[model samples]
Target: MTDVESSPLGSERERIAAYPLAEAIPEDRLNAELAALERMDEKPLPLRIPGYFRLGGPGFMGAAATLGAGTLTAAMLSGAQFGYKTLWVSLVAMGSGIFMMLAMARFTAKGQTPVIQLQQREHGWFMAKVLTAFLGLVCVATVFNFGQVALGTELVESISAGLGVDWPREWNWPIYGLITSWVALSYGRGGRGVYYVECFMKLCLLAMLLCFAACLIVVGIDWGAALKGLFVPWLPRGAQGIDLFIASSAAAIGVMDWVFFNYAGLSKGWGPRHERLARADVYIGFALPFLLISFMVICVFAGTLHSAGDVPTTAIGLSKALVPLLGETGAKYAFLFGFLMVPLTTTVAMSIVCAIGLHEIFGWRPDVRSWRWKTCILLPQIALLGAWLPSPVLIIIVIAAMLSLTNNIVGWSFFLLLNDKKVMGENRSKSWGWNVGILVQVTMLNSVALMWVLNRMGLWG
Candidate 1:
């Protein structure tokens, strides 16, 4: 055979030809041939994974979504009522979230397995099943979580009507849900799709941040007071301040987002080699909420709304606060854009999380086209839509409580596996890393659990 004929492609062709006429080519061979054909038709390129931090794509899309309706609501409420004092809660939440997520990413990257699968391996079938059930509940709760955004969007539209601009509310929830589903479906398609959605989310967040910052600048608020509000953590005089702090804290350490974020990292096939990039991605994601949403929103409210005693219960309320500082046109547009992005991306993230959870629970293969998987995800959301009018504040509080109760379950599962010599082997968390992570998880769980109990008892109010 000539040199070209004796090449790997030629050898593969020879093997296929040698098979019995009636016999089918092996699946592996068929896949190889198809891959070869694809390569032949395309230019030779370096290996690159899209939406992978090390490869130059953002890794914060999931977290950004987590910071959506719930976060925005919390920030608006905190700022309007407590001004910069509550800003510290957001900062603390962001800091805590960053640390936990970094550990999550590292665990996934080093283990090279989905978090659910890791739980299954380390904890056995029964525990795995229980974990799956827990996750499934969380997934169901996520629909409510996504519903917050949809409801928020509708509220924004309602508010805008006073400005003579009417956004249609016909089938609003379904339309928003579908749009959110589509964005998520696109992410499942590959890295390029995720990159597009993440970019769009960032743009929306940036606009809101800029508008809030501009208003703060124009209002000429006391820099000293604003700075003091951020750094000086003080509890309000009444029980309400403590309740608000707990609520805001819960919003910040939102459990579902962390679970979803780690899974996204695994879906992208991030490994130890990408550790630095993953860390950077987590930092960037954490900063978006801390600097943009928390700081800027607080400044806007502290400078204008607090001074006027105009506390906002929703994004629209905050927008009204902005109107005086930024004019009606700017405030309306900024709030509209921010409101839309928050729900849209959140719905997308929740959809994907639900889909992934279903796949894990039932051993359903990860095929986007699988009717079983799609139904598993879509059905729950449909039920949520029929259940109630979406309540952003209520959903945020519920999510926080749910996460607080379950965080220990998942966190302990992971921590044990990371430390177990048989599971992680040489990949175990370092001594200092383990100590810090354990301390943080234990502290957070206790704090959140206490708050949850207090709220349940109606003592928090």
Candidate 2:
């Protein structure tokens, strides 16, 4: 890659507001900043297994955020409904996430302006503000975070059941609200925010992966069907097709995941030289764990729940389906523990994403310790309260649907940025692989969302 300092892409003035503090830094200080970036970049990439593991964070956060309660619920439902036939969805989802993340990382490495600012500066689309500020905050951080709250509460109740204690269902809301609030407040400083959350998510992902993998082994999965599901795409007949569409969309990391990953990379001080490390982070830290845990969820569900013909309407219900395979307390408690960790990580991870998005949008100092912490970071919780009320199943479904739409908008917008000379610089153009991959993302996410919308509008009939 050409050095960002020498790249004759957008002028310094043109890259204004690329970061929260970029515009105000004087010109000579620009060189000092770039020099510091170069100093960090000069550090050699990690070559060993332990080295790569040590170098990872952003992808762990991305994986943690992607495997939220809704995603767990959706994966389980797919397993319970269609069995291993939909394993391809998890692969496809991870593939799309890597693709979108590549473009965002390239933008981070090459452009002086952040992707969200670049979005707003785009003349016609006018998407940056909505994609980051509105959707990142409202649709993603708030609306979806609400579902995590509900899922967290449900898991709490499920754990209560497993313990043979009749915890009142009425207390789930306030109890979870307080617990998640405490979790959110723990990120008191910016660097500490990223490190604490990343370490926490790594533990959660490892625990979830190990627990489910062990369970799936105990159940003796059909490798033939599992391989086929990974390589081949199959949807059940009729209305199930629509469900497959949504499940597939949800399985992929959406707009919020993309934004969070890029910002997380920035949080780690990643620049052009760390580009390959970034990809490794996504593949190892995010995609592997995401697909492994996801496939395990699907397989375990397919073996027990689908075979038994039980429909799971909630996260707890899905956990309870594990009872026959592993016995009551083992199944529910194991599932409950993992389920609680997934949404809890999401609640904490997305708050940082919200904070970062707000920082980019409002030019706040990128410090999590200041008033910016209150507005940029913590403000979304108020909106998240909407998920706590008696949200109709339809409302939750609508939020998930809107996320699919937001993923499309952000994905397609970044695809264009991959080609924008001003944004990505000359040597920073996208490869044919990334180009084809993004085309697939735009086609898959947008077409499915459009089909769902058309079906709801009676146009598909």
Candidate 3:
């Protein structure tokens, strides 16, 4: 990796730093898109709505990446331990994140500069490096990979055993690495490959939602309580409560979520004309799917395992807990298949984020064919050892809490950049409501982190 302060930019890397990622798009296609945007202004509302919907890709990829093990463990534990009490955490956390997500969209579309470069120019070199290394390398590429690998390997192993094939559990990581690396490395090959990758993410998001919703239906829930839990705010007491709250909220939106959504937009070459389309993508592709999955997962466990004496901590154990409730074979497989999608889809999306982030951090022009890109994308494969690791629940919660605490730094940096007049010019946000939303997000993040600390120290709960 090139040192940001010490290294001088070569011509090719300098060009990459100055322009929008659209510069990498084929000239004819880029021209065609610009022309289409021009004609889109003349089209009526009904016609443009469909076009906006079709333009969604980045949001779903973000959804896929964050919807992995951290989310699953948080939701599962929340439902089982607290019933519907922590439901509002998911809503507020994700809602608060929207402010930052929209801020990123506007900045990327209007500025057309990569976020890392923008950070360096506006915030100084050290702050930029901290955000890049922590958010990009540590959060996504390291800590987050632990849970995804552990849960993913367990689900695959369990599924195979259920089918009467007894593969050795020790080799699970190597097999998983081969399969996921092939799929992730296939990205950026061409237009069709990118489209297929987008479709695959969409399918994974849809399937995960459907499977969890089915399980929720089987166990059945208290609609009135669920609604109250979701809309009403009630904070649970003690260290465990604080930890769950932090985990659920942070998992919804954290360092990785911001990096993935921002870079994915750049990768898709979105510009000023795609601004509205980007907002629609956040609500439709990312927010809607994420909220539904989290809600249903919590509701399912609340109904089935809330009072079940002992709740399972492992993925396989959780699926098996649903067996009596769902009926033999039908219950475990349905839940396992849906649960399987969580890690599988997440690993693919996170690999892409890692690739983009490393390139930006090292000041290299991103190329799908580059050896560095290939190596970075496959870095999470080392996490397959998570198969034999301890409880994913603990691993995921620790990762989320760590990110939530550090999120203060990254969130503030983005907030500053978004409101900078020199950087955004007239495109800078003027909305007071958006500013308040971001302030609330930062406050909530720090408060939860603080609460966890106090509770751990036995000073407060």
Candidate 4:
């Protein structure tokens, strides 16, 4: 296990001082090292799924972080209400997401600097701080963290009931929050091993994947119909299609997704040689598993709720919908446990991601081993006491609108950075791949956001 700090570019603290990571090492110096590696390993990276999974980290971390309860709820609802109609959005999201990740990977692979640092260097500090860093880490992720903890608390209550524990309802969320805060701590500053978060994410993703698969099998899906739904894109009349489109596109790639993966690459000590690993992380780790799990989840609900002619509006409703197939107690605990896993993984992973960004923004050490990062991870626990309290609809809407606006700005800004020769240097692929990616991200994100605004004004879907 090579130390990430053991770079030729001085010590780890020195790298932190030269924030945005790339600035720490001279371009020519890093370039020479990459050239040497390329010369030593002549052949292209082969498609080795198993080996890649073992090596990949950021993508899996992204998968775990991105596909939180929101994504699951959306997929289940989509299937429950419209059967396979919105399945095509998943395909589009995945396609758009892969290219978006690869575009960022190009930045990490070449710049060796995190995107935040690049934004600061190329544009200015305000752009980096207020727009990208603050909005992403604090405004966006932090706000969402409250809802996840609240959901985690709810799941804990359900799990307790299933276990026949007579715990007080009022204490459930606080207790669950405290327990999960500890879980997040284990993977924080004092954790063992470098790849723990990635490994943990993969484990959670695998578990969730298995849970969904088992649920699907128990319900018995219509494979022929599912396949067609997958290939054929469908849009419901009115605001539903636009709303799903926005959610799907946002799910495909968001501020946290972009920031997390780029930072994850840095944390993994990825260099030019590890570019293949980065791609593998995005395509194999994040995209493949994310889509598979989502498809399975959708299929499970579609098989049952579609025939039942009922829609599940809440997570519990979605979970209980499986009762007919898995029997009362079996289905109750199955989806309950499955949904429980979603927020736990996101909580831990997002905490680390938040720590990463906060450190960069506040000029703290980038190392997760630092207490600063650990404390940052735990700060969200404060929201647990107030977790069950109702968040204002207008407040939620305002935060979401801000997030969408910031995300669109970040997507376009980074896409421009990806093309900037000064930033990416000769490392830029400048290929059609990233070109198409930025287009997909921009179109979907902006159009959906616009529709949401219009729908709010009762103007359009």
After superposition, candidate 3 runs with Cα above 4 Å error: 1-24, 27-50, 329-331, 391-405, 450-461
Model 2 is weakest, by summed lDDT over 10 consecutive residues, at 16-25
Better of 3 and 4 by lDDT: 3
* TM-score, structure 1 vs. true: 0.78
- Top-down lDDT ranking: 3, 4, 2, 1
Cα RMSD for candidates in order: 8.4, 4.9, 5.4, 4.9
Off-target runs (Cα >4 Å) in candidate 4 are: 1-47, 187-193, 328-332, 367-371, 453-459
Per-residue alpha-carbon lDDT of model 1 for 1-461, expressed as tens digits?
63324433243334333212101224463344344434533543232222223232234565556566656777777777766776677677666666567666666556555667777876875445454434434444454554554555565455557568776454445566666566666654432454566565566556656755665566556667777877888768766776676667765654455566666655444444445556656666545544566677666667667756646666655665566566555564555555566666666666666776766667666765567656655644553343245444455555445556566666666667767777666767777865576658546754765686577568665
Which digits, one per residue and each the tens of the lDDT, describe model 4 over residues 155-202? Answer: 777678768986543677766676566666655232233365567778
What RMSD does model 4 have? Answer: 4.9
lDDT of 3 by residue, 1-461 (tens): 42222223332234234433434556566457657766776898777766655668878888888788868888888888778877998888889888888887786566667777788888876666666554544455655676777777877778788889876557667777776788888777665456567788888888888888777767788999999999999877656666778767756776667767767776676666667777878887788888889899889888888878878875557766765677653655778889988988888887777777667667777777789889988876767767776645455455545555567877788888888988877788899999999878878876776665555456764
Off by over 4 Å in 2: 1-47, 172-175, 188-191, 328-331, 383-388, 392-406, 453-461
Question: What is the TM-score of candidate 4?
Answer: 0.87
Name the runs in model 1 displaced over 4 angstroms.
Answer: 1-58, 125-129, 132-137, 140-143, 146-150, 159-163, 168-171, 310-312, 315-325, 383-402
What TM-score would every model get versus the actual structure?
0.78, 0.84, 0.87, 0.87
What local distance difference test score does each model get? 0.58, 0.68, 0.73, 0.70
Query: Quick one: best TM-score, which candidate?
Result: 3
